[model samples]
Target: MSYPAAPRRSAVANAIYGLLNPIPFGFFVAAMIFDIIYAKTGTILWVKAAAWLITLGLLLAIIPRLVNLAQVWITSRRFSTGADHVDFWLNFVAIVAAILNAFVHSRDAYAMMPAGMWLSVLTVLLIAIGHVIIAVRYSTDRGYNHV
Candidate 1:
């Protein structure tokens, strides 16, 4: 007899993933701020470097997931036995967000000019919201006891 498939994530899991999505977003925002600060005051080269380093760390953390997704694409195989399409989509979105962050940070820093702080704030807000949603979803999926 064939065994039944595993159950999909509960509501709690979804909530967890959603909440966690903002973490990277925050990093990106901070990186942008760092770039802006450095541009304005080039004397603190170390500070500027530190800011970029943090941003790189955040991107690196997500690279594994990105690579895994790519591998799945190349292999033409199901990434998961469960309904993990959400996971894939969110992961891809995170990668996109990171890239955008990198671009903005690099541009602002290299130009040695102030970036649109208002736009940066808006972007951070959006990313934070995405993070919360993803955190909720993923946590619930992982069977995290939300109770």
Candidate 2:
């Protein structure tokens, strides 16, 4: 007996997904740097603005990603496994951390500093690891070039 062929996404859809894949990570990194600067410099308006702007960008990027993942699941009848799944979870964790960080920052409370800073750090580290995993997978897998 033969197994059914896997559902295929359109080339345009795949290309869009590829183009958007790294964007949130980029924004996360920028936001993390700005947050660190704000922490050190103590409430510099521009730094805070930059961090918030980048965080918003990150959130915007996440919407397309979630849609893409949903499309994949709808078409293929299964969620991705291995590296793709790991990347998804990592992004989820980063998004949650960003939201928490934003909440703490908005409160403008001194007592929240430790929690907010820790969440920011966690977000950065998770995004960095996720990026590294994607890079390694891209380098090692020739098949991804076709996608």
Candidate 3:
């Protein structure tokens, strides 16, 4: 028996993925660090920065999420890895946590404490796992899977 050759992403898709994927992660990681700083220093600047970073991360995540949706949901049979669904859910949950973190950060500095920081930790953890899934699961011969 023979298997199909791997589905190759268009250069545009690859370009978009490569370009956009790291940005939100960077923002979120930065936000996480800021949250930690806030926890350590009890400084309002750190919390406010964390809020901005979370908001920016959410905004920046939209495009890459769309790309992943196109692959994991719309074209699963054609191109998505089995683990893509896991990746999608992980990112989706992380985005949700970031949204909650943003809302929490809207409160007074100390009010947002702990909760916002925890949410940031959750978001970062989910995204990190999602990134690992993409790295481990995607391959030419590994192919695709259905939902």
Which regions of candidate 3 fall more than 4 Å away from where they truly are? 1-4, 139-147
Model 2 accuracy (lDDT, Cα): 0.67
Residue 126 in model 3: shift from native, Å? 0.3
| Collision count for each candidate, in order | 30, 0, 0
| Tens-digit lDDT track of model 2 for 1-147 | 455655465677677777876676666677667666767877756356645755675667666666566754565436354776677677777778777777776755444556666777888898778778877876765444544
Candidate 3 lDDT over 33-129, as tens digits, reads: 9989999999889889888999999999999899878877875446776678898899999999999999999999999888988999999999999
TM-score of each: 0.41, 0.73, 0.88
lDDT measured at residue 95 in model 2 versus the true structure, 0 to 100 = 78
Give the higher-lDDT candidate: 1 or 3. Answer: 3
Best TM-score goes to which candidate? 3
Predict model 3's lDDT versus the native.
Answer: 0.87
Which regions of candidate 2 are displaced past 4 Å?
1-8, 77-79, 109-112, 143-147
Output the better candidate (1/3) by TM-score. 3
How are the candidates ranked when ordered by TM-score, highest leading?
3, 2, 1
lDDT of 1 by residue, 31-132 (tens): 556555655667456345634754664655464454445433544345342334454555566555555544555553445334333334444554555456
Residue 98 CA displacement from its true place in model 1, Å: 3.3
For model 2, what is the error of residue 111's alpha carbon versus the real structure, in angstroms, after optimal superposition? 4.8
